[model samples]
Target: MSETFVDLGFVTAPSGVVVLGMAGWIDYWREVGEPLSVRAGVAAKAGGGYLREEECEAVAVPAAADRPLAVRATTEPSMFDEEPTIATLEIELGLPWPEGVDGPVLLGDLPVDRSGMVIGDGVGLDAWTGQEDEPADGLGDVTFWGRYEEDAHARFGGERIPHPGGVDGVYGWLDVPMAEAVALEAEISTWRGGVWGQGVAGSVEPHVDYFRFRRAGLHHPLNVGAIEVGGCQVLGIDWCQGDHSVRHHGGRDWGQAFPVTLEADGTGGTVLRWTIPPYDEDEEG
Candidate 1:
């Protein structure tokens, strides 16, 4: 049989330069008994020694600070984590792989094979905070996600044309029978980089991670794909700018793909399990 596989490149690009490498002076502005504050931007002075919104950029408040109003101000360069631990995503494809194993490695920077790839509708579940990443009680598709791409040059407000051949990859969804499709409900879960503690903190661009589906059912407003098979396995990578962006596929690590597995556990229901690689956290820094 011919190979039934394809690769779709990532949608967005990644950041290249290491933010901390640049040389800049940062003044550590702190009060004796106040929460350590990291000025984000400019603010104006509202009261005594207080910079208002115009004079400063942004400020961070520690959860465990003694003084409620004690703030810090300085003209020093800020230090941020270049690679922040974003979120984790997992979804169980009910059907087994061709050899009872996982599928091929997907590079996110590759281009979607419009001819072979099917951009179907799909949904995203808010499951990170829950046991099973599924809607607690909703029967129908609750969350929906879409697939979109921003022209690299347009995003940067540049006039450079993307390299010839654009990108190359294949993506599509193959539906499992209704009985099987219904048997497999999305147990997709995702997590994002949270509050930046003293050990770690940073900001992120507004970009949605999309999973295009082939099987149609319920879809997330910002997700991609159709729910057909008993389950699904998606692929992509964290990307960075310059040559590194090409490497990451989209500031994501194409090297790893989250695999969510669901199987019958004797009683005819489903047993779900997911595997995610260990990543760096803010603590223990």
Candidate 2:
């Protein structure tokens, strides 16, 4: 079968770079503390220092960060041979499922993925914070994640529930059908590069990292996208530029992920395929 590619849209890189990872930065600005205030052109001033929102390109909303993020939708999940752990630093993982299993891990309920806005010359999570590095060549890492819980389970965790896909009465209703081996398939095409997609890609541009910083540990899945004004991810760090924009196909309905089957393999190894869209959180409603 021909390779199926999906474009999520563009991510603005006004400073010539972008940061990708979990929503830890979002948690910092929106939840953890008050945002920084703009002191000058595209720069938010803090006690320690500031970051420049210099524009390498024009954008929408006069400064909003935006960009195109595409994905290689796949059903063929890359299997691990030795079940290697993906981290070096040990930290707590607040997962609902046990460790050791192929899971579409949801980043929402994370105990890690933390950040602060500090760094030397002012680049780090908070202060002591500076722009996190993406490959100097303008590329970041990409990988896959599956839920640590059961691959297939009814959306509501109940066996009997009518209209499992919609709000029969209220949100979190038990009527939704079970989702198995399901996930937000990714590895962006258009807007590529980042520490990780968290759940999606950012497609950051080169030299843009100077103004962008990301946190480590836990985060909401869409945190990366939230950072972009399409151009502005750091709050209070403002500038005079048009808003950046992006396009995505994450609006597909439940169990309606796009699929492309591979030629049958007789080998004993398992080959699973999945059809996925851009993971539009709007569909949850």
Candidate No. with top lDDT: 2
lDDT (Cα, tens digit) per residue for candidate 2, span 15-55: 32222222224323323233222221233111011221221
lDDT of 1 by residue, 1-285 (tens): 111212221111011000010000111122222111222111101100111122111111111111111111111111222332212222222222333433332211112111112111111111011112232222221121112112211222212221111222111112223332233222211111222221111111111211212111112111222222112222222121222232223211234233323333344322222233333344211
- Model 2, position 19, has a per-residue lDDT of 28
Off by over 4 Å in 2: 1-3, 25-285
Error of 1 at 136 (Å): 38
Q: What is the lDDT of residue 6 in candidate 1?
A: 20
Q: C-alpha displacement of 243 in model 2, angstroms?
A: 34
Off by over 4 Å in 1: 1-222, 227-268, 277-285
- The candidate that wins on TM-score is 2
How many residue pairs clash in model 1?
73
Every candidate's CA RMSD: 26.9, 23.6
